[model samples]
Target: MKFSAVLALSAAVMASAKSVRNHYPVRRESHKKGASSELQSQLPAGMAGFGVSNTQVTEVIIIWTNPGAGAPTININPPAGGAQPPAAAPPPAAPAAPAAPPAAPPAAGPQTHHVTVGGPSGLVFVPDQIKANVGDMVVFTFMSQNHTATQSAFATPCDPLPGGMNSGFMANPNNSVTPPPQVAMQVMVSDPLWFYCAQANHCGKGMTFSINPTAAKTQAMFQSMAIQQKGKGAQSPITGGAPPAANPATPAAPSSPPAAAPPAEAPPAANPAAPAAPPAAGGGVQTGTGQINGNGACVCAVTCTAGSFPAAVQGVGSFGGMAGSLPMNMMEA
Candidate 1:
């Protein structure tokens, strides 16, 4: 009886221990052989536990503690017999912003040279010849009647050179209330330049100017030369700067002398040797041809009386004195 009681007690203790193991499984680090080391490496650091899974016969819920955050759960429900793939790394960070643009250049100073055109004067360019540098600008302000700053060759005083600059005629003839117009010519080249007014007889009247002239060929010399030559106005064929004058007078027709009236026909002369001399100083008559009477009859050679010959034969006349015969007086008839 004592041996049997001891055996029964040993069996009861074994049953209780097996029941406790099945009811509450103990947590343990995985140490099973043939377990995927690659799958273990894919797991995030600080993984705490896993969850139940229907598929993969091994569903796993990752409980990991993120940096500076609470522990979060990541449930991985891969297909049966398959491992869950690891999450992809984040994209590379964006580049920094670009640098600023460069600064602009400084502004230039004001223009120094200037020329006045027709100021107070009826037709003139004041201070016409001005010495200027290559970069200087010359302002031309018209202050009075018509004028132009037309570039010309010094040798050909009033004429404009090909490709030379020209400020077209600015005309304010009556000196109205409006301010005079202005045009500016820049000094691009260092050589001397000649200019003239191209309005009407302004150029002819020696309305000219020059710049940078040599000592030998100064403004005085150019003016003297221009004075001798006729002024080629703006409307000239070469420069063609100005328009034609308005309301130009029409030329009158020439008068013609009046024609003389026909002389009164005289009665046939009694002597046929010499026909009645043609009435003196009236309409001219052919000397060799007989005079025709008012009745359309021709007197031929002083022999045939008036109306004796047909009108068609009237042209035929006496050969005598025919060499000096005058033309028939058609104008008088």
Candidate 2:
């Protein structure tokens, strides 16, 4: 009776086990359907069909089967003919630095040049040529003889330029004057400047100077031209005045009138024609006694009666006595 009881209990347990196995398959099918639906809903819009693939489902199942595995790498390829997500933008770059400043200019300064005029070297400008810039000073110190520092033209070295500078004749005769004479000329331009001594014959002797001479117009060429000009120079200052004038001539003397004949005088009884009154004594006419003439006219030995003529004619006709009046015939003679 105990055996029979054991058999019945075993049969009952077997039947219950069969029923559980049958229900497990049906429940598993439902769970799979639900999981597929949920997976499709979670997928991005338009990617629902991607999850429907058996391969994608298997991958999902593998991922769920191993929960302890490292995170899965999902590489979602872009759909054909569909807009894709924009890639994340890269970061921006940094800024640049500033530049440096410029440099400054140099300074300007003036200078001076010294020159000797007519020194012991003779009629010349010692160091006759020099270079000078604008605003520079040129001091010309005279040494000997009478000399001048006069501005001249390059073309005509001996001739003075109109309105040009001139240090009038500075005479240092024998170089005896103290401190001598000096002339200061400022360099007004960078071009060539010609100068010469204006004293007579000095320029002709090659006494010349120059400032800023050039290759084409050198100081030697200027001196040569000055010498070729000979000793001619500007008017001399020694006269201290203008030129002089001319002279004039003199006048002649006047003539006198004739006097009336005096009363006739009787002839001397001793001689037929009174011996002609003794000829007046001196070389010129002399006064003598009166004599009667054959024509009954008074005859006097002198050309005029004493005291009869003007004072101007007193000693003109007679040597020692006053002049007298003459007869008309004698005056005519």
* TM-scores for the candidates: 0.36, 0.37
lDDT, model 1, position 256: 85
Instruction: Give the per-residue lDDT digits (tens) of candidate 1, residues 1-333.
Output: 699999999999999999998878775647653365656555443221232222332112221211111223233233222323222121123347459645745535323345666756645666758776554545565656666677666887777655555556655565551444444434545778787876766767667888788897787666655555655332333233355567967888877877888898898778758667755554334435444656665534321222223446544765643222223443234
lDDT of 2 by residue, 1-333 (tens): 799999999999999999999887665467889997886565323232321223332110000100011323232333222323222121122236437644644424444466777868898887788877665556566767877777778989888765565655666778775555554445556778888988888888778899889999888777766765664432223212233444544555566666878979987677476666755543355545555656565545544234345546545646764355444454443
**Reference-based lDDT, each prediction:** 0.53, 0.58
Q: Give RMSD to native, each candidate.
A: 39.0, 45.1
Candidate 2 local distance difference test against the native: 0.58
Model 1 TM: 0.36
Which prediction has the highest lDDT against the true structure? 2
